[model samples]
Target: MSAPPATSPSLVLAHPTLAERKHTWTLTQPEWGTALTLEEYLHREEYLTTVPLAKHGGVTHWILTVASAPPDQRPILSSCETLRKRALYSTTAPPGGGGVAEGIAHGVGSVFTDPAYRGKGYASRMLTMVADELKAHQGTLMSPSATAASSAADDKRLPPVAFSFLFSDIGKKFYASRGWVPHPSSHLSFTTLPSRRSSTASSDAAAAAPPPVAAIGYHELAELCTRDESLLRDRMSRLPSSLEAHQAPSSFASTPPDASRPLTYVALAPDLDTMLWHLMREDFITTRLFGTTPSVRGAVFGHPGRRVWAVWTRTYQAAPPAISANTLYILRLVVEDESAGEEYLAEGLRAVIDLAREEAAEWGTAKVLLWNPDGEVEGLMRRSGLTFEAVEREKDSILSLMWYGDGPGENVVWVAGEKYTWC
Candidate 1:
């Protein structure tokens, strides 16, 4: 008797239909729903779809399935979402108008697979298909300069997007295998409690001293973001294009040999719209959990040319079995005076951290978290006499990036790889 071998079905990846999207949510609710009931989690997902940042097709949902599967069976095997974002690309040192171009980049998030389908390679297959769609999808909004090249179809054709990023919660190797090289994954953390004094008198005296920084609210965030973007552009303009010059050499095992293409510097601008996406999400979740929104958005110190400020958001978590505790995370920390004396700069940074601690205390968070501090910030933290823990994140929130442009991927320096950049 002869036996016949069975072939596996081909997989297809595309946008999820309305029913498929909800089905995927229902599947993942047990994993990430936390304190919310299944119904409430579903409602939150619906609300997020209508946020300003997600509108106008800025956010897209994708799913993978067996090509021959019937529609009524809910064939979704894996799913994820991509967020459209504004990015800056340049190949020149000074970055003149001709060299500077504004285009779209994407933030990947909400990756999930059916628990029953584990070890079947479905997630990897889905990511491979989504990556292609991201690179070739048309109607990408770009500046006129960015779209000036001739096209076989349209009068002007924009170049493929340069890069995309995601925060990997499962560790580095998984995403790195798929082209997302892991970046810096360190953070500075401090408890919200004030430093203990030796005596009651000393504690009272310390409490009597005025706060070192000023509180910034939601209304001021947009203006601050604009200023931050200008400064970011200026700083990146002065930076060298070579990745070796920017930081330590690549240690990622999957990074390929440097290509012959020209080196380019790309940055995801910390603009108003980007900040709003994060802030809106935080406000939505925290308001629903606590019945009120957090009032202080960030802390500021110094003035004009020499100021230092930090914008932060509160993370609300249900107690116990959830491994992550409630926290106040500094989204963006700007230290304007890189050349200032150690003593002066440290003092300003200290004030900002103190304000952050106070804000964390008010919100009942356990700690304040600052991610990927620059060399200057690290130096000041060492000398400022503030007690803190500097640790590298291994398992979660590991910043990962994948390059898709024509230029050398090794040359892409992720400027301001802070918490704000996370989707």
Candidate 2:
């Protein structure tokens, strides 16, 4: 169907307040699909209402509706949530050793259009409205001094949205038409077949290996929340600088061998406090939504001496192609000390994989999926005897990582370590 007239003043963009949450919830239920139970929906609603981030303005949800419809018929046409964050973007410096340049980014997710309203351009209109809102907000934050020159400089120095991003189910072309580009990254999937060999052989080989020297332990979110803040803070502070790089600006001259080149990459760099808050909030919501059943759990894994950590949650797969009935999604995996080397991170990952396999066996599923695994971790997983297969084209769900505003799309590479998606 053709889009509604572009100039129609009857269209309304709104951010529903707490008083209108019930109405908003009802509108969203259809978008969430019939797979989610009413109890699950109520759990999500409660979590959204209580999360500290919402109160602090770190997140906001938006909706679009027709202004002329009667109060009961003013159905929400499209909806999405925006996460405000200072994502880290980096580019290699010119040859003589200037470090990577860094900048902030904004993350968007959970975009949905009412099924009955699809093909009418509601989603596109809502996206445009959200982009405008973000652009204006970024302008205010980047230029508190508010000088014309500063504003002009901000326009040139930053992308139209500073940095806008979303994971698209609609494929690259759909988003590309709206000026968003796919992130340069790869997601890896691995499957472990159930062992048919007898338990005695497996037990005997394990007894022969020197007591599995690496110390691996899992702690629930409740326990992690009580751990000393200084530990996590120090770990976050010590992460590598290259992990966060900005795209190179167009004006920079090509540096010869002597000048340091710019490092180009996209990353989310939440501080220790923010990271902790995310863990607690995610745990609160997922536990209630998925329940305390054996199929799901929210926890963190730590290696010997607490030198490395990874956060993850195991739950039943709800998305399509049925790759597996159960899956473990890694939220963030970090090495507090880079000097620990790939082997160290590899060992931590292997432990997590082992745990996942054990859970999968118990849950009767055969595969594990990792979204947007970066080169380093991907290499380690391969080295640890895990093989990857790209989701078959016919079965693929079109997981497109699209970005908008500022910097050339080619200069940015989205890595998986810092960001977390509940699904």
- The candidate that achieves the highest TM-score relative to the unseen native structure: 1
User: Candidates' TM-scores?
Assistant: 0.84, 0.66
- Give candidate 1 regions above 4 Å deviation: 1-10, 67-72, 93-100, 138-160, 194-207, 243-263, 319-324
Candidate 1 achieves a global lDDT of 0.72
Q: Single out the weakest 10-residue window by summed lDDT for candidate 1.
A: 142-151
Model 2 per-residue lDDT tens digits across residues 1-423:
333443467777665444344455666666552335556665566465344433344456666766665444456777777765555444333464323333445566667775677777878888888776666444221111221112222444543344667656555566656656544333566565453223436658655342122322233433343342333334333333342332223211112111232223445543443444454554544455445434233222455344444454444434223435555555555444456667766665676555555444544455656665545666777777666685422112333333453334544444433335322
Positional deviation of residue 318's Cα in model 1 after best superposition, in angstroms: 1.2
Instruction: Please give the distance, in angstroms, between residue 92's alpha carbon in candidate 1 and its true position after superposition.
Output: 3.2
Candidate 2 Cα deviation (angstroms), residue 269: 2.2
Clashing pairs in 1: none
Candidate 1 lDDT over 1-423, as tens digits, reads 111111244677656666677788898888877667788788877777767666555677777776555553646777898887778776563436325556677789999988766666778887877777777543322222221222222644545566788889999899988878777688899888553222335647766564557788888888888889888877766765544454534322235436443456667888877777777888877767777777778888888678889999877666323425888889999877778778888888888888788777766678899987876688797798788998888889887877787655555656677788878
Q: Per-residue lDDT for 309 in model 2?
A: 47
